[model samples]
Target: MSLFPTYKRFPLTIVSGSGTTVIDNKGKEYLDFVSGIGVCNLGHRPPHVQKALEEQLHNVWHVSNLYQIPIQNEAAELLTSTTNLDYVFFCNSGAEANEAAIKLARKHTFKEKILTFKQSFHGRTFATMSASGQEKVHQGFGTLLPTFEYLPYNDTKAVQDVQDDQVAAIMVEVIQGEGGVIQGNKEFMEAIEQKCRELGALFIIDEVQTGIGRTGKAFAYQHFGLDPDIITSAKGLGSGFPVGAMIGKEKLAETFSAGTHGSTFGGNPLASAAIKATLEVIFKPDFLQSVMEKGYFFQELLNEKIGSLSVVKEIRGHGLMTGIAIHTEALPVIDELRDHHLLAVPAGPFVVRLLPPLNVSYQEMKRAVEILAEVLDQITDKTINSD
Candidate 1:
């Protein structure tokens, strides 16, 4: 193979996609519940994002950050205007955004330590991988960058007991997407914010997998009435067009002055066009409300179909991001789903993660759940036969 074996890719090869369906190279169609691991929140090749990208292609694809780029300004304005943040630094992926947030937190507070929760995922870059709390991600890295402490998720007392004075920030995801689709406790989440205030540390929300209306809000943090000092966004920010942003409050604006940080392709015209268009669509009140309704309907369908199955453990999530925690390994279930012409992914060893398009139709959800029910039924039958 010419490329490095970084990903153990799925067996099927998808050639084209539209809306909630993807067609493989052999022309078989599947309901795409994975949504590119929550990156394609608006569905594949969404028309609004497509139009904006085409227009930008006619104008300009790239320009140096040194020059004035009006499209970048428009994209940044959309993010700042929608949230409590004042400034935005655009980048190319979630890892870059988190890296920028880390740099800003340390520079702004003059501190070295950061606190993240165990079972959390940040990204694959050196700094972001260090920020991630999962040890498996750090294995063989040979002495990762220090000063990061991993706390237990949803533990209010652990955050309350933080006594380190050199902590620069406490970074967390509202929903631990890669950590088995785990939701953060309201009391625990608030305590992190409060503890940051108590310790003079920046409150950072890593919205890489949950931002841009993924959870029926402009950002998932909005659901909890929490105002984060630094919000790192990617994944669905550009509707799968590869863009990330680091948003911060007004007070720390001067910390990242010129020559401090930048990306060559960050906020270029094409990326800016995609980000602006995607945000315009997802930020709409009606659209986000529809996502909420669909999520409720989807989860209800799953419960109605397979919630009681011996192999099924629980169904949980927020908005279009849902998970089915099964009693068995998630990979086998996911493979069976794919074989039945449906697609989902795994959040961990036991949680089957589902991230359908926000605009996925009701019928599509029903079909997905039916396929899931069938898959679980087969597993149940096999167990019964063996017993």
Candidate 2:
């Protein structure tokens, strides 16, 4: 194999997509609940973003960050205006954004330690991997970057007990996407902010998967009414285009002065255009409200259809980021969904994660739940037979 065996990829090779469905190499259409793992929040080839990208194609694609890009400013303005933030540092992916956040926190505070929650996923780079709290992600990568502590995710008491003087930042996710779609406890999230204030540490929210209307808001942190010092975004920022950003409050601006951090292709004209157009769509009040309504309907529909099943434990998540916690292994269920013309992914071992586009229709959600209920019932039958 020429490529690293990193992803246990599905056998289907999707050739094209529109809205909520993708056509595989065999011309078989499948409902796409994955949404490129929450990167395609606007769904495939959204018209607004596509138009912007097409227009950018005729103008320019890339330019170094040293030169001012007009669209980059527009994109940054959109981000800051939507949130209580002041500045944005564009990067290429979620990992880079988190990496920049880490660097800025340490530099601004002149401290070394960062506290992340257990089961959290930051990214794969050495620094980001160290920031991640999962052991499997750290396996075989000896001698990680230092001064990161993993505390229990929703344990308010654990956060209250942290009395470290060297903490530069306390980073967390409002909803732990890869950690089994676990939503952070409201009290715990507030306590984290309080602790950051108590320790004079930067409060960082990793909105990589939960941002861009995924949780029916521009950013998940908005749901908890907590102000964070730093926010990292990516996955859904560019509507499938590769882009990331680290947004921060004005007080911490000077710490990331010139030459402190940079990316070669960060916030290039093309990416900026994509980000601008995407924000123009997703940041609107009506669009975000629609996502909120859809999410409520989808979750309610799932519960009505599959909640009473023998294998189902619970269905949880905010907005379009739904997770179905099942008693059985999720891989087989995911495969069954794929076979039945639906596409969902696993959050961990037992939770099936569904990230349909923010614009997914009610009919599409009902269909997805129908397929899920059918597959889960079939799995339950097999389990009973085996027993």
Candidate 3:
């Protein structure tokens, strides 16, 4: 069996990685800016994460939720203390975390409808895909879990227009990562909170991509100063290990009794160890502050170097999760950057997304900016000469 044919993968076969760089099968070193789609916050093979996993491997790996796992309790405590949420339901990926959140909202409110915004992406699960505002991902998935309504993002009026008491929850992403890294306006977020309160709907924030310090804040929702009834996190939670969590207020979390939901490998010993180590590192004041500083440095350098290029349109997003909107398609530029030993991913048709490791050094940032500048100059010169 030749692997499942799903992803249109890149040509290089990455064999190993360290810090913010990866080595392909041919041993070519490339700086990794995608961070495994915002999962590897501490970069590849962080010593603490590695040591924790190594130590756990010898002790025990899996023990179903049937038994008591001290690590699980520890992970939950660490996570809850870091955010406003009260409890955590650990799972394996962003989709599972979102699935739990959806279930919690429905169960808590005893309602059916869910309100999401346009250009939002929650996850790939059936319910999440249904809740997602992007049509392309839901295409052919066939009538999804019912009672989901999509409204225009950042439009308070659109949210206000939805008149449905059956609305169970309002799910949002403070920074829409897949939606070209657009951040929801503060007023827009406050408006949603107000509407949720008015309509008695649970407010949910999908922080899978923006959580765990990707947005300079521990959780992107904190930046808006708004409290959400439920929150989902995954990407960087375990720094490379698979771990997702649905966090909710104490009362809301209690809505799901024993059999209502459970995952066999969700909070296994090894995963918990990874989570603990990652949290210890990412939640540090100095580390997060550095991310904020580096993020500013990166945005400034990017704008200074290529912001005026004819092919560039705009730069948007906050902290480390940035998107560059270009006048031309971003795929060619992404591939070209790979040729120059840099890596980036395309967010939308015309936008290149950057989710570099939170600990990326200043020198690395300078190198990345220098390479991007050179590439943009070449592309511009080619276009001019052809004209």
Once model 3 is optimally superposed onto the true structure by TM-score, how far is the C-alpha of residue 156 displaced, in angstroms? Answer: 1.9
For model 3, give the 10-residue run with minimal summed lDDT.
Answer: 156-165
For model 2, the stretches where C-alpha displacement exceeds 4 angstroms are none
Tell me each candidate's TM-score: 0.99, 0.99, 0.98
Q: List model 2 lDDT by residue over 1-387, tens digit each.
A: 799999999899999999998999999999999999999998999999999999999998888888879899999999999888999999999999999999999999999999999999999999999999999999998988878989999999999999889999999999999999999979999999999999999999999999999989999999989999999999999999999999999998899999889999889999999999999999999999999999999988888989988899989999999899999899988998999999999999999999999999999999999999899998888878999
- Clash totals, every prediction: 0, 0, 0
lDDT of 3 by residue, 1-387 (tens): 489987888887899999999999888999999999999999999999899999999999998889999988998898899787788899999999999998889888999899998899998888889988998889987788878888989997887676778889999999899988888999899989988998999999999999999878889999889989989999999988999999888887569888999998998999999999999899887898999899999999999999999888899888889899988889999999999999999888999998899999999999998988898888888888989
lDDT of 3: 0.91
Candidate that would win on lDDT: 2
Question: How does residue 215 of candidate 1 score in lDDT?
Answer: 88
Candidate that beats the other on lDDT, 1 or 2, i.e. the better one:
2
Q: For model 1, how does the per-residue alpha-carbon lDDT over 296-384 read when each residue is reduced to its tens digit?
A: 88878888999999988888889888989988899988999999999999999999999999999999998888899999999989988
Query: Which residue pairs collide in model 3, if any?
Result: none
- The 10-residue segment with the lowest total lDDT in model 2: 61-70
